[model samples]
Target: MNLYKLGKFLCTVIFYPLYRIKVIGKENIPKDGPVIICSNHISNFDPPVVGITSDRNIYFMAKEELFKNKFFGGILKRVHAFPIKRGMRDRNALRQGLNVLKENHALGLFPEGTRQKNGEVGKGLAGAGFFALRSEATIVPCAIIGPYQKFKPLKVVYGEPIDMTSFRQEKASAQVVTDRIMEEIRQLHKNHR
Candidate 1:
């Protein structure tokens, strides 16, 4: 098995039982195609959880800081994560994301742009929206419910794909698709939790 799947398996063996993770609506994930899994970010733990949501190997757009440490950065790349400089339009990161979709791989993103430590959801950025509209990738909005407290019951609900084909003709902006994605994530939070 590849490092990504191997790491996932080890994480499942090690962390799953400890956190009592409950992954729901995984069936909502498309079995094949270029997919963008947009989710809420709360903690560092969210990345692993997001990767686990899809059966396929998912690439992540992580912050550039995560790659500063040589060892950890190497591990991140080995597991299919690329760095993005936050708060600016990092063209390199953008290209990396587009390439992932162009290759028809699953790309994971946090629409909020960064983590919300207060445990409350935040407004999403327009990045995910740009990706979906540009690549026409299937977007599966997901929510990570419950606290990340040790041994707590943390759940991940992968909701249905957000269809924007109808909105494409109206000259919808990236923010429009982003709002819809966040709405679906919030709905998952409401209905599942």
Candidate 2:
């Protein structure tokens, strides 16, 4: 097991029970192959919450700033978390993400790009859609509802996977594809909200 998997397992064992996490639709996750787990960004804790609840290991694209600290960078590296330069369209980050999906690993993407205090689903960036189309990966829509207060039960809902084969054939623009993916995430949150 990789460091991230080990760390995630340890954290899940230690914190999930204490936090009273309640994950729903976990089976909605694909059993194998590459998939893009698109979710709403509500808090800094969202990534780990979804990561632990997921049956498969998920590699997340974290902002480059998070790796500034040497200690934290080492830990993130173990979990397969990589840094992405926010804004200005970082092609290198996108390339790295594609490699992960090609390897049949789950890639976690927060369409909002950053944590939103209001929990509103902002316009999702084109990266997720682009990667899905490029890698021919399924897009799994996910929503994490409720504040992650200590000992409070949190809800995580994973929706059915959306196939991108059609989108690829249509030669859909990144914005169009991204909007479609974001709508799925929005609907998931709306239902649970």
User: Top model by TM-score, which number?
Assistant: 1
- Clash number for candidate 1: 0
**lDDT computed for candidate 2:** 0.86
lDDT string, candidate 1, 89-155, tens digits: 9999989999999998999999998888876668999898889888868999989986887898888
Worst 10 residues of 2 by lDDT: 145-154
lDDT of residue 144 for candidate 2: 84
On a 0 to 100 scale, what is the lDDT of residue 131 in model 1? Answer: 91
Misplaced by over 4 Å in model 2 are: none
RMSD each, Å:
1.2, 1.4
Per-candidate TM vs. native? 0.96, 0.94
**lDDT tens string, model 2, 44-72?**
88888888999888999999998999999
Superposition-based RMSD of candidate 1 using all C-alpha atoms, in angstroms: 1.2
